[model samples]
Target: MREDFGASALLKIQELERKGAKLGMAQKILLAETGTVEQVLSILTGSPIRVNVTSQSEEKGVISREVVLTSDAGEPLIRARSKVYCRNLPPAVVEKIRRKRLGIGTAIFSAGLETFRKITKMGVNDGIPYRTYRIFYRGKVAFEIREEILLKGGPGGI
Candidate 1:
């Protein structure tokens, strides 16, 4: 936990999930301050979830994806750019992740695994955006997440 930099709700979610707890960021935001996880998606949306997979690639023992989660109306909500060490995850979980069926937190949590997230950077990119977080599993760097939350057309955008 990086005191001044980290403490974002995303981090909290990451902390909980890494401790074998399930994540419901969409719901948690409603209950507390998100610290520094950026304030773009600070407001949760009820819109239909949509995933725009920017890219999916695998090299060596790692598999990564750059995904944008948006509303059905095309309002970008959250960006989850991540890389996972395939060899470190269960095959079933990997299959689900590849099929775009489970989220990084959910995938790991469901597999009875926890994550360690370290926020390397934070700032606004497109809509209150920036770069943040490196997710770990059992002390091994399993995934790195770069996120951007789009505000326009989202929950509070309207």
Candidate 2:
């Protein structure tokens, strides 16, 4: 039974790696739509302005903004948000990016699963308390999210 479980886990890891690559590609495409790394940073900074990205032919690509204003009681208010569109990107490129994003996601999930397995095994063999194991699992999830963000975007946007 243990051998079967191990084999299954290995297979999952392979699948995850493939998915992670796809996810990476997707992230690249999305970032590319912002024009430059500086532009992306600006958009993320909640500056109250609108940015309209355009293609080489001057066609509108995508629009980014720090706040979307709506009227209430005859007053305008800002709501922070950012968005991307397929129209701004080439169809082929969008498709490729989507595939890549999925791939990267898969890879990350596989790695996480593998780590969990190893930790669980150690806890079982060492007779560690179940409560301690649960704490480790919680820590793992928080660490994973942090690691993912860092890996996806370093100190600077690419």
Candidate 3:
């Protein structure tokens, strides 16, 4: 892959990691073997990933937290976390969504209809929203989200 392509591919992989997808070494190798970065991107993102969100409010403060996962089955394959801030719609939250810190469902819920509209508008010109994210814990691959909307919507709309 070209340098930019490699970077894009890596970004997609990171996005998958953020979304709680546990990728084995073999999967990584397979991604490399796919040759075209677009192909790799397709494989990494072409499905919905899972996430969990939690929030708490006290007299002095309000706290929102999120966890992303690869599956809703038994245990999650991977995970990521973030603290929601006052903006309600911070770029960090969007970044977290892109990175998969917030799963697709949670992002949609957290972002609400307006944010979704914003994302759809942005996504129109961006080809597909591509993001880089990380995994806090690692594990074996148990399942993958097979839905395309979950995969392609990216972090912007989450």
Candidate 4:
């Protein structure tokens, strides 16, 4: 658990494109369309975040990591995993920045135009606490992402 946990959620949805869509997922969805991680989390869940490492390692030439992102009170909000090829990144920036502390937008900014390749897969179940996704980035699979939205009583009462 991270000691940096912050406050209560006052999140709300705003109309975009006049379509009345809500904030969705932990990927670049909000980071690209709405705002930064903190901004998106605050408006969507109205909560501060604490991250816990689930698993991490270097394998087959990439750094793989899994993390659980939770609210200050311990409600799981997002579970994300990423495989990044640090060698493909700038050496100077790589040395100065801490990778674990990066948010999706920041990572994209750092990598420069690293966009999503496709949504490889997705799943959801009512009894479960999370929704899963598998996303890939372009070019020799420079990065791949798998994330889960862990909010309870998901989206609607349904």
* TM-score for each candidate, following the candidate numbering: 0.63, 0.16, 0.29, 0.55
- Could you give candidate 4's per-residue lDDT for residues 9-106 as a string of tens digits? 11212222133333344422432322234445655666777666677777655677787777778876667777767665555434323346755445
The whole-model lDDT of each prediction reads 0.60, 0.27, 0.35, 0.49
3 against 4, candidate with superior TM-score:
4
Worst 10 residues of 1 by lDDT: 30-39
List the lowest-lDDT window of 10 residues for candidate 3.
116-125
lDDT of 1: 0.60
Q: Find the candidate with the highest lDDT and give its number.
A: 1
Candidate 1 local lDDT, residue 14: 62
* Model 4 misplaced regions, further than 4 Å: 1-39, 92-99, 110-114, 129-140, 154-158
Mark the 10 consecutive residues where model 4 has the least summed lDDT: 4-13
TM-score of 3: 0.29
Query: Candidate 1 on 40-137: residue-level lDDT in tens?
Result: 23235555566677789888877879887766688766777788888876688788788876566656666776666666764443324345667676
lDDT of 2 by residue, 1-158 (tens): 25664464444434544554322432333222212222333344433323222211112443232322222222222222222233533355334323322221233343342223121211111211110111112224211110011113223422
lDDT of 3 by residue, 59-144 (tens): 22223343434433423332323333323444544454445354533444454422211011111112322222211112321111
